[model samples]
Target: MNSFDSSIETYLSNLHFGHLATRSIASIADLYTFKGLVLIPVLWWMWFQHDERREWRREMVFATLFSGLAALVVGRLLTHWLPFRVRPVYNAELHLQFAGSDLNDALLSNWSSFPSDHAMLWMAVATGIFLVSRRIGVLAILYTALFICLPRAYLGFHYPTDLLVGAAVGIVIAYVMTRDAIRVRYATPALRWIERHPAPSGMLAFVLCLELVTQFDELRTLASSVVRNL
Candidate 1:
């Protein structure tokens, strides 16, 4: 396993190009990891505008949110329990090739790179969406592989195995969350509560959007601090 990881990282790190095109591709890929948030508004519109698909739309939204949240919780727990693993960029033994200034020294200071949180969340969302609509699910899975996971690996943020394990965990979480027993036991009650309380739900959604768009760095810093202090 170690040999396989090192070989792949070596091959990829050797292929780095210091060009504007490569930088652009890496930047676009970084953005697309968080692009699942874009579905919120689109699903919102579909829920109201397309009455016939309202049930499906609602399920889709619920699945996405639930899966993403579950992935984060599970991924973080695993990271905390597992031994620390340095990212390729920070590992002294590895040759890391970064294309642009987007990846800075401070970003590479952490040693929590065993399982990628980004891959876990995005893959979970993709799998959840797949359970809702096959076409969108297939697209989401492709996006996760091509745009989200590959770019991170290309940039030396994670080893390929980190993504594979994280993605597997995500898929499992999505499947568990979509189970009929789990849905009836948890999701139904939660959805009913949200439906009964619009103001709080809207406020929560606003806060989530704000955090995702503007305060993600701060949130990540806080989360890291909590994990370290634990």
Candidate 2:
């Protein structure tokens, strides 16, 4: 597995396009991967589709968000609980040729890379979409693999296996979570509130999506500060 990972990374490292162009593309991909603004609009498009099962659509959207959170929590727990594995870029053994010159080495120095949270979260959301609309779901999954996961591997942030595990786990969790019983239990009440109180629900939903786009960075930062103070 290590050999397979190394060979793939080695090949990817060698294909690091020219200087500025590669960096720019990677930067954009990185931004979209976490911000997920690109995918969110697509999800919203799915939400408002003129289908009879609008409630089911909304329920699946809620399941997407809820399952994404589940995937993230599981990813983080595994990241911390399992033995640490350094990112490919930091693994001197791989001799990875970084595609870009700029990286916040310090920020991720302590972070493990055995399982990618981005892959887990994004794939979970994509899986949820797929559950709702098979055609769109296929597109969503493909977009995630190409537009999101590929860049991370090319940039040396993750091994292919890391992404595979993360995505597999996310897909499974989302499939189960989006099951009729599970989604109904969690999303029905929220859907009812949205139906009854459109104004408040709109505002709250916007805030929630904003936070998801930003990966809840502000909230996590505040939590970290409180933890440090304690």
Candidate 3:
């Protein structure tokens, strides 16, 4: 075995072992990942579509989401490149005492363990969305902690500290992108465009398209089907 493998084995061995399962905890985690990460942010923007004070309407919200996505992409890219540590499953020397069911190749990940992409992505989005509303921001942070951070740990993908650092990176990036002047500056052109259009459905459609594209793998799988030939 290579030194890399030896290092990874040692790291995984040091991690505290817990009984891993793919049961109720995983299901609950999935729900939070979807609702908190996906639905809530969209719904929050929709609810305040008519609020003129927010300075975040169609194009602005779209831009902010794009910025959040960019932040997450960068975070994931760095995590993939840097040699941090490895998850137990990938540690060659360690015999895992409690093996959970494989989460299917569809959900399988091979990223180096440290900063979790899930935590970073959702937290970044939460930070961006929260800037428009404090209630939404607090809710976003809480959601990221419970849904993204906790689940990654419970599922054995990351250490609790990994989630913490990921969230911190996400929030810092989001804040840098959404500082007061930046928000106002970016929102101006968006506001002008909205003034010209003044319809919510168009903006909503565009945002939905972005979300769908982000989740294109899932949609593509759904589009294909199992066929039985006689």
Candidate 4:
């Protein structure tokens, strides 16, 4: 496993691209990846698009939302349950050089980087999107792997295997969640309830989206502060 992680780590670190260009990218990624400005909009478009299968797409939206939340919770639990591992950037042996201006390390000193929660959440959502529309789903997945997952590795927050494992788990969870039995049994009722209570539901949805877009940073920071006070 060390050899596998090191092989890709060595290559990415060796890319002598000017640190300036790399910093620009890291800054852009840090700013936008968590913002979800692009990705969430795309999902909304998918959900509202006029189609012969509008109901199916609506169901899929719920599946996407539920699966992503589940993956995020699972990732957090695993992070706590498993042994702590240092992020690649923090691992001295890697000798990784990165533009730190954009990387958020305020709460990462002790955060385990074993399986990337971003990979898990985005991939699970992407997988659910794929179920609704193959073409869009494929694009979403590609966007996720390239724009989202790749940067985690490049910026030294994670390793190749960390992403792979998270993605694999996310994919599996999404597939299972989207299965006919689960969707019919759960998503339908939720959708009906959402329809019946638009105001409160919309408010809750907005909060959930906000948290996801920010990668729960605000919540985590608040919790950390509260713990310190306690």
Deviating ranges (above 4 Å) for candidate 2: 33-35, 225-230
* lDDT per residue (tens digit) for residues 107-155 in model 1: 5566488798777887887787777778877987897788778887877
The CA lDDT at 161 in model 1 is 95
Question: What is the TM-score ranking, best to worst?
Answer: 4, 2, 1, 3
TM-score of each: 0.83, 0.91, 0.66, 0.92
Better of 1 and 4 by TM-score: 4
Whole-model lDDT, model 2: 0.82
How close to the true structure is residue 178 of candidate 4, measured as C-alpha lDDT?
92
After superposing candidate 4 on the true structure, give the runs of residues whose Cα lies further than 4 Å from its correct spot: 33-35, 98-104
Which ranges in model 1 have alpha carbons more than 4 Å from their true place?
A: 32-34, 38-53, 96-102, 209-216, 223-230
- Give the alpha carbon lDDT tens digit for every residue of 129-226 in model 4: 78877998898899889888887787778889999999999999999999998888988998899889999988998888777777788888899899
lDDT of 3 by residue, 1-230 (tens): 34654454445434543444455556655554453446344644554677564444444455556566666577757876888676645544455421233542333344566776666767777776676667866876787687656655655566556667777887887777766677666656666775677578467646654553353335534644432221
RMSD of each: 3.2, 2.0, 6.4, 2.0
TM-score of 1: 0.83
- What is the lDDT of every predicted structure here? 0.72, 0.82, 0.59, 0.82
Least accurate 10 contiguous residues by lDDT in model 3: 97-106
